[model samples]
Target: MPHFFSHNFLLLAGLCCLLPGPQNTGASDLNKKRESTQCQNFAPTITNISLFLLQKAIHWPEHTNLVFSPVSIIAAFAMLSLGTKGNTHKQILNGMGFDLMKMPETKIHKCFQHLIHTFLQPNHQLHMTIGSSLFVHKNLKVESKFKKAAMELYNSETIPINFKDIQAAKTQINKHVMKGSYGHVLKVVGDLPIDTVLALVNFISFDGVQIGEFEAERLDKLEFQLDTGKVVTVPMVKRQGKFYLLKDNTLSSWVLMQPYVGNIMAFFILPDVGKMEELIQNLSHECLNSIHKRIKTRSSNLSFPKFTISTTYDLKKVMNTLGITQIFSNRADFSKAIRDEHVKLSKAMHKAVLGVEDKQWEELDFPDLHKNLLPDGPSVEFNRSFLVILKDITFNLPFLMGKIKDPKTK
Candidate 1:
């Protein structure tokens, strides 16, 4: 079996913001609280976008695992909207679940600027990088204002490439994505169209270590039941410790919150036998907030599967489904981005990678509490399909959301 520790492991990557350290002064504390409040206010929009993608993913084949970064997609489109005008700009913002009347264009960009800056802050426990880049043809003249806004607001890079040389252009774009994602995603653009004038690329990479202990000797193969009644063997890591566990009767699922070394939490939702569809349908931003409020600390034995997953998406089609059709059509307007030429978005690509390893637990400084308390709590084995949401606890934002049908498949 291919384990998550392997070098080929590809996990979902998303935008991650660092939490501010403890402050002693009253003024600093007040600023920290304000930052937290701002993030909380902006979180619902991103979460709604993730839910829309998840609902669309249900139409995919049953065996196919789903993984994507809502934060990355939103940031990329938000950056693109900087150069867009008229209906194109409105469509992009509206499709992202933002109301322009309440939050104008300037406020929207400022919010993203704050997010990108906070996301790039130094954090030792969690290693993450997220960025967007625009690859324009060498002959094209991009407006200085658009370039300046993209750089100052979104921290995005604008690179000029000679599209006439298809292979070189592809390699150049791929290298940018590789560097931004810290080499997790090797290639994002496979081929460049002959008339490709501009390409927008977004990449995010996230690495977090476990906060609990998992003995290597305890790693064993266990039976994993699929949704279609098929059983498969998978590597399972077991540990008993204190965690936030919730049994939601409304959704017919058990929610387990696992904390990482940093201010990151992974929520594992296991539906009862065949209630995956019900859980998926009932899942929403409001529902998740409710779950967060109801979850309580308890002792439990957690048996989680070790796995890695990666996904690449054609964002043009994905955005189209969300009613963002002008950017890909001939009527597209990017006058703010390019000067004296009508340039529409030729290609939009996004890739994310994620890997979970049991070895990460070895680095944690947890005490041996499982030995004395293993028999006192319920055993929660993830022996079937489940949903995973990786959230940044400080901002109350879920960056990556995935459905794990089979660990072996990835």
Candidate 2:
């Protein structure tokens, strides 16, 4: 398990909310138009933050297999900002790569509301759930306004608990997370600090079935080389078909786009030997846009590993690096959340889990000639470290991103 500190986890834990129903026919269209505009304005910010975190997370020590939900982290902090004041509020928004003057606070929340609602909608191909739970001290008096926004916008549940009873509080939090993630994430809080007054948790769960027409019997152990020049054997899935592919000489990387059953697209980026760092440094919003625009369909043979990866991060240090330090310091101001006393966030922890299904396909007998023949076109094999992004094509936003260094590593 790779451990790092960052503010993205809260967003994942709090990414889910109850789907809002239409009040009436007259207001539905107007509300949707407003939400569409907000989402269009908010999509780029989410992409920038997702890519930025992906770059920072890959550099963390022992992060051979990394996975996280950027949408969840953004939503969690957007809810937190509702309770913050002064510089604390500014830092949270600014750290998320949002411009206060252009977007403002209200618009930001509305945008998040729209984004979360989109994810909660029913999809036959994808099973996804996003939700948030706020465990606050029993004595703490939460402002009505903050509570209302957290519930309405983020669908966050604020449950008061006795902070003195640490074990009970911890159990309650873990239970909420477990239920939210459908038991994929068993425990999020092992221990709660003695002085802890509030614990904000967010979780997101995704299960996607591949829409690629690949023979399951093609699954076999293949060589996966690490950056250290060591190759290990692992189960690799093979597919041959027309795919949207790109070969960027400038970045020395091959980008392969794979679609799932839903409108979800997964972009697998395999850099040329030892070019991972350069690819990361050069990757930007515009570069990604160009890649999306320029990728052409071509017949190719592709092989990618089957693996499951999870990450837990302590976001205090990471937030500080992003210029969000006030929330963790003595000068912290959460006046809007709790007006009765001074409260500074002591700890911010985030954990995310993602799995690509490994199906068991029975072996089939085939002729020697058919087995030996290869598909016509370029052969791209992800038998090494690479980046994978799960994006929603509808909104053009990234929900999950990760760097897979070793398929065998859990």
Candidate 3:
């Protein structure tokens, strides 16, 4: 039997545990009272509202690590002040706090139909959490000013005393996801709406993917260079209206980087950098070569999405940062399997395309395709802003796990 430590040791250990003391009974009482009260003013400030949400996200007794579900957080804010006065508002708030959000798309007010639909659109985890927080937090300030000014104007108007101004704030992402939606994500005008597409155009201004009457001559030269590996100067054609990538496999599709990052975070729920690279390599060596050989003998001119091959060294650097270490056992077998699958897929695709005409390709426009431009573009400019999100998740994952810090870092 070992001797116990003195009273001083017990007191010091207890102090370090952060357990609430008897002196702070009133603070606990206030929170306990808040649990029962339906006070509109409880989360009045951005700080308070954020703290309220953060407490649920980080400090909840369950899942002690810094694991916050972005979907939960965004849905929480989206539905937080939905209909404050009626049972609808209460329901919305309740829905936010719940684990799985069946977005009450039907019940949302008509004026906020877009907002309701926006909730249905898929959002990146970090984007959803941070953007929704900023969205509600900003509106808290705006509504504060607006509330003091317009009682008579509002009362005189036809609508009811519906102050549930579903804060109509738009981040860079909202432009694509909420613009022309039918299912959750709305459709948009053209590829120009995608950030990376715009960035690419700015980086390398070319005549549109399709050759028009005016662009016919310049496009001929460009096509020649692509085919023969000979340099040719191509002229610029000012696109009067928006142009979508005329139907072809999206060589530079945004699916490469983003979903990969999300999947790693989401534990490979969908494709990410590693898979995308393999797909790209396969497309270039097999698909592009096959297309290249076929088109050379064709009477009609050819068109495909232009892309550049980075050196193996450059590719290695990009892959490493994205955690793309090639596992020894799986890659070759996976590639072979993928190749076999693509072979079958290609045969089916070719059979399906037998009756289709060239114009059909041009008419193919993925209006709802929200192309991610991050990982597809040049590695030099892939913005590290998203690292903040991954970093936050990192620092918090340990806390969420309830692991003691090295005692030094803490």
lDDT of 1 by residue, 287-391 (tens): 887988889887777778887766666666677778887877767777788776776664565555566665644555555553443667787888998998887
- In the order shown, the candidates' Cα RMSDs to the true structure are 8.3, 6.2, 27.3
Over 1-410, each residue of candidate 2 has an lDDT whose tens digit, in order, gives 32322221122242222122222222234775667665677778888888887778754545667777778877887788899888888889888988878877778888778767765555512556667788778877789888988898988888888878989878888787776665656667787778788888776766653425543236668999987789999887676666788998988999988775435677889999889888887877677768888888887777778776666777775566578888887677777877566777777766766666644432544334434435577878889898878777656788887788887877
Q: How many clashing pairs per prediction, in order?
A: 5, 13, 13
lDDT, candidate 1, at 96: 89
Best by lDDT: 2
lDDT score, candidate 2, position 185: 60
Off by over 4 Å in 2: 1-34, 58-61, 209-211, 215-217, 362-370
lDDT accuracy of residue 389 in candidate 2 = 81
Task: Supply the TM-score for candidate 1.
Answer: 0.85
TM-score-based ranking, best first?
2, 1, 3
Positional deviation of residue 53's Cα in model 2 after best superposition, in angstroms: 2.3
* Predicted candidate 2, C-alpha RMSD: 6.2
lDDT of 3 by residue, 274-320 (tens): 33233323332133223323321111121221211110011122112
- Worst 10-residue lDDT window, candidate 2: 3-12
lDDT, candidate 1, at 90: 86
